[model samples]
Target: GLNTADLPAKVLANRALLCSELGLADQRIAAAHQVHGARLRCWELDEHPPRFGSGAERSRIEEADGHLTHAGGLGLLVLVADCFPVALSGGGQVAMLHCGWRGVAAGILERAAQEFDASPVAFVGPGIGRCCFEVGDEVRARFGDVPEAASGRMLDLRAVIEARLLAVGVRAFEHLDLCTSCRSDLFFSHRRDGGVTGRQAAVAWLD
Candidate 1:
């Protein structure tokens, strides 16, 4: 999930530059227009050979919120501003997940966990943590008893996510301890920036 943030006018321009800088141009550089959900799409470094869903450019592969593949070269992507962009890999495969509160409540982690059928290394990316995610009671209830907004309430969403992953047998993981709202100087923050904010994309692939 790469972002078209302050990089350049063309998303792929920045993408191409990034790949060059990171020495990933030889690999399959893949990305998508994300819609927060539990949907999964797979891609490969082959001739896609068709128009896209919106009938735009003929892409090299498919699109969805999550992506998994065994192909050695295709890079997996997911975009985020305040959502949890996760990267998991094991057994010569990798998966990238875009999980917001809705996706989390819908058990996106569980979905990714199920993909392994055993276990995998999960990487939870930087996003709006609970400290900055002040929501009304309705948002809390969606998670089934997370407590009221209780006014000016904030939870450690990182800790919660770790627990969620662990509960599903994901024993190994790494978290980029970043909060968009708290560390606005580093990453984009939609909440703190008042909705008109740019997104930061997270991506991972095998070397």
Candidate 2:
């Protein structure tokens, strides 16, 4: 339970422990405060350095929904409760994105795909699926052109994400269609829990 909602003191400790267990040294992990926007942060090993986790200098970088790096062994982390955590990799670079509906609509995945030198492979991790994501007409309208994205206000965010990535030249994709709202035994769902819930971590790195 890597809770990103800034709870008690033990939350940071939990994150530190998880990083150690995953072999990602505290100083070598990078994270960001997700703003549900399409902002992307590009990191160069030498210029950006590592910037998150439980060390002295560790800090979540600026507000961004996506983080990309060419540095191997440096983990890029994103926390999600019901939002999708999408990982993209190709051409010696990797990116981890916190793709909530707002971020997807803002073209976050497309931006990440364009950053790659070649067509990147994508892994769309678990999130609230259309089966449980009943939204209002306004939200559903955002994805009007994506055939599979909406069904009578039930927003299929994953479909929208896939369509966007494909439009941006991403050729390969793996999707874990687990719905966070329905799989209560395995995931924490904000909507299911009425807006208060823990988060799961999605970490990506090369090597």
Candidate 3:
């Protein structure tokens, strides 16, 4: 997951690059947004997904926390600085999830894995590793088992998430050990920024 939170416009501007990577230069390509909760949505060219906003009539990209696609050339986008940008694809379907502790506890991965047509392959993008993701006992308990990370506390989200995936029978997955909190210069961190930080965009598409 790339952190382009502060640069949604830039990420949007890079549509051509996205197209090239997804082999979608000829078709209209779009991205779905990310929210904190566990609501899932699938995207199509006819109906665009909503983005983050406040309004009565919203698009799926605006409201959905994560998205999957069977449409060719279109991309499922997830923006993250420290949160997990989970990308999974199988059975001609690809899905990207913006997972925080809330999402993990909400069982987003399990839902996604079950929703996927075939076995899903996941990529846990750069985020705050257990070394940086410290939490209190209450929050740690929510995620179930707090692993000691950082100066104090035990709640390594990535490790916990990996275990969750395995528990759900999602055997294909990998985590990029880079920690956003540890490397603030390279990646954005909501924690490092005290809540205000830019975002990186993680995207995937079908060929």
lDDT (0 to 1) per candidate: 0.69, 0.84, 0.70
For every model shown, the clashing-pair count is 2, 0, 19
Work out the TM-score per prediction: 0.81, 0.92, 0.79
Residue lDDT tens for model 3, 76-141: 767777888898888888888888988888878888888876678888889888777778767777
By TM-score: ranked, best first: 2, 1, 3
Candidate 3 error regions (>4 Å): 1-33, 45-61, 145-152
lDDT tens readout by residue for model 1, 99-146: 887777677778877877569998888988767887766666665433
> Which number leads on TM-score?
2
Pairing residues by index, what is the TM-score of model 1? 0.81
In terms of lDDT, the poorest run of 10 residues in model 3 is 51-60
Where is model 1 poorest over a 10-residue stretch in terms of lDDT?
Answer: 47-56
